[model samples]
Target: MIKIILLLFFSLNLIGCKKSEPVKSAEKDDKYGDYYVESSIGDATYLNPILASDSASGDINNLIFNGLVKYDKNIKIIGDLAESWSVSEDGKIIIFNLKKNVKWHDGKSFTAEDVEFTYKKLVDPKVKTPYSSDFEIVKKFEIINPYKIRIVYKEPFSPGLISWGMGIIPKHIFEKGDFNTHPANRKPIGTGYYKFVEWKTDEKIVLEANSDYFEGRPYLSKYIYRIIPDQSVQFLELRNETIDSMNLTPDQYNAYKSYFKNYSKFKYPTFGFTYLGYNLLNQLFNEKEIRQAIAYSINKKEIVDGILLGYGLPATGPYPPTSWAYNPEVKDYEYNIEKAKNIFKKYGWSDYNKDGWLDKDGKKFEFTIITNQGNKSRSVACELIQEHLKKVGIKVNIRILEWSTFIHQYVDKKNFDAVILGWNLSRDPDQYALWHSSQKKEGQYNFVNYENKEVDKLLEDGRRIFDEKKRQKIYQRIHKILADEQPYTFLYVPDALPVIHKKFTGPEVAPAGVGWNFREWYVPYEQRKYEMSK
Candidate 1:
């Protein structure tokens, strides 16, 4: 069963040395308005919110676009374009009241037609948007008036509003040509706080504040993001003052703690995780006992401590430790080498051959574990797991490939026995794309091919469930079943360390966990001052 945990608990460590510390001016004339940040990753496909996989695009888009609904630091849903909303008695329809005074970057009035058009684009089968599945339950939308919209669903859907919170595109911009090829794609105009100024591929993207923004002009004049793909290199850039901020790995965190203790620093658990996934399509992995044996054999705690170096939290199940849907009552797959061996023997695959390799009908037990390249940490973790499995007489071969080739070949094709990968997580819990029986095949994201009718029903019901407490209970039940099936070994959830220069300051960080809060952040010209009040 696919499970989702829709809670807002974050492990945020507010590490600020002193807010009133003396500011160091590296450059005179105070070009402090230009705060150049760096990213350890690059967007190969610079698409809109519906197409981009990287959270970096989401962060940049937030600055250039306005959604109907937005979340506060505490994840409380607040009005952006939609000022107020009401739900029907049947819980299948939502009526939203939009603000009439808002205007797009191009000076066009923002209205319900724009919101309605955005939803229609996602549901268009020809668009083939990666986010199409998120709106499958949305049956229809009717524009009651220029300032109001009534959305009707096929079934009860509690999370319907937030899912459509992505920035709305003006129907006029898309009418000229396909959004993918339109010049507007590169230079988008939305009702966001900032307007898109320029984008140089693989170089940098710059944004200027919109004076007519509904929230008033942003504090900073301009924001710049320099894209660079190496994490270690990003740390060096931040240290050298070449960039104002970047995300730092745990190893880097320990190396630079002293410098940060005298400045402003913050760390929070990210909405991303790395796990070991098994290919259910493979005949060798079809056996339930074999899957359990692999999951039970490994010592997860050791891998987290050694490879991650205390940077991540051990995953008890598919969800993180902080997730409300985590089933604490469920029995964890603790390390038990003897129990694993016995389970293998009970399944008639115990006896080692003359060469000391486990065999069934004189056939050696072997499989391959794959991982994406570029992430050296994940490759090392896979090698360690290979050694652990070898001790149990199970032959393991490790294969690492480039990130693009790995996702296109091994993962998308379901062509590997196992793989180590990470998931870009969201705040809401909708597991249909990865867990439902219907998505087991096709170009869907469910590479594991896990199928169960019972779980599918629970997920479908949970999607329509309006009560938050009841939805949590349903997900907890689904987590238990996933623990039993063992489609993937839940690894560790890491805390993202986004390195910021001592000069920058901002509002409360977002709980989205992926650190996409650029819209609310600003650099002050006077660095020695306390927090800037909005």
Candidate 2:
């Protein structure tokens, strides 16, 4: 669930040089120069792809690592490190033909052994990673040679092929130490388009183009990721031309349409949704009716229209409307304060003391909703929900914390009443890590502690079946059940509004957004601005 936001920026010229033209040539030698600078709200916690769950780490990891497989511009599964692959007729075994001449950043050879080591570490019970579920079903991993490998699965896992898309760790570097505390986590060495150069805590992360890259040297000489926690501060930096790229908020996208002439903006629906997930461990939220009542109390349309400024759609379930598994028949709870009040009364929540706040068993009905700081949209949405719930005789409090603290301390530990967060979904519909009852352990995505026997069976069945049609039906059933259960009051799917500076080019408006061909994106020598030190 790592949200990848592509932010490409251009440098402003002080003299009277004309704006840079779009990249039109396919020649790689002539297109290399300049540095692209982007901004992030939080600093990366871990650069190691396996343990990095937050978006900040994901953004950097995408540049510093290469997966065995990757999604193409059309969101189709394609080869990355692997040149090609074949699957058995039973769909339980796969053979991967890895690309030759690939080398890790430290000049070490990348071979089948590295892939095998990464798989072992991923499924190691001692490792604290949420991605273990994806690889746990592997029956056997056999290395045919340095450049070839065969994998046997316990069953026909529908998401098996794409799960190899997880980044491969270098065996030589990680084998001798505790991987969870490895110093290389901050200074990663990967066989990728970029090489990690520096990571200044809470300040910036710098990466240089990998000259020895197997595919080809990247066009941009450097990639700078700046950490600016506040959205308003990020906009100020954008206005001053300090940063080249950012994901503009809905209000910013609509308000600054004509302001930046040298920048190109693209808007598309995101493959994710925001939600208010209740911690089922809390006794207050354990009741299904009370959860449904909370869902009915809030107005999703208000959030989409008011907070999102109509740049999003109200989410009905876990999957976005764009997903094939999304069940259009699953209806959201209508905004009904009276109905919510009735449901609360049925649960013995009432203002017995004539106070506005509801009380039952000598305790007031109240809970705190925690969300990460610097996200204005989620904060405002929480405020709106607080107002709406108060009308239904529920007192609510909101707590905003830093991104690292929010995830590590509050979310992973299950020490909160509720959380207003978002999930950046994968292309495949298998949600075993997020909803299956067995995945409720620490560091797992199922932090809400939602457990349904039917959901567990459906998720298992969905993964074992490969037919798109059959998997679609199973996921639709899951969507319907989750919508009815109300484990999360699914909120909205916002549009991805990313603006890129015009000096750098080669960006396209494809189904996977503009960054799929990032290695090819470049700036002409004439238009080059920032120079990197050796």
- Residue 180 error for model 2, in Å? 0.4
Inter-residue clash pairs, candidate 1:
none
Over the stretch 1-534, how does candidate 1's per-residue lDDT look in tens digits?
111211111212111111121222434433224443545344333436554433446556667777777665565676778889988977889899999889988888988888888888777776634566667788888999999999899988767777757668888787667765577767778777678888887677887767687766654557666666555666666676776665555676777766554334557776556778888888778888888998778888778887767877877666666677777887767888888888888877775555756888888788888875445567777877888787787888999775445655667678888888776555566666678877654335677888888889988888888787998999888888888888888777877665566565553554643334444445555563322222
Per-residue lDDT tens digits for candidate 2, residues 1-534, read 222211111111000111233433544346766788988888888999888877778778888888888877787777888999999988899999999989999999999999999999999998888898889999999999999999999998888898888889999999998999999999999997789999999899999988888766777889898888899999888887778887888888887766667778887887778899999999999999999999999988888899889788999998999999999999889999999999999999999998899999989999999998888899999999999999988999999988878888999999999999887778787889889998889988899999999999999999899889999999999999999999999999888887888877776667666676777777766666785222
| Model 1 spans > 4 angstroms off | 1-32, 176-187, 198-200, 258-263, 346-368, 399-410, 413-416, 440-443, 507-517, 526-534
State the displacement of the C-alpha of residue 383, model 2, in Å, after optimal TM-score superposition: 0.5
Alpha-carbon shift of residue 125 in model 2 (angstroms): 0.6
Clashes of each: 0, 1
lDDT of 2 at 11: 13
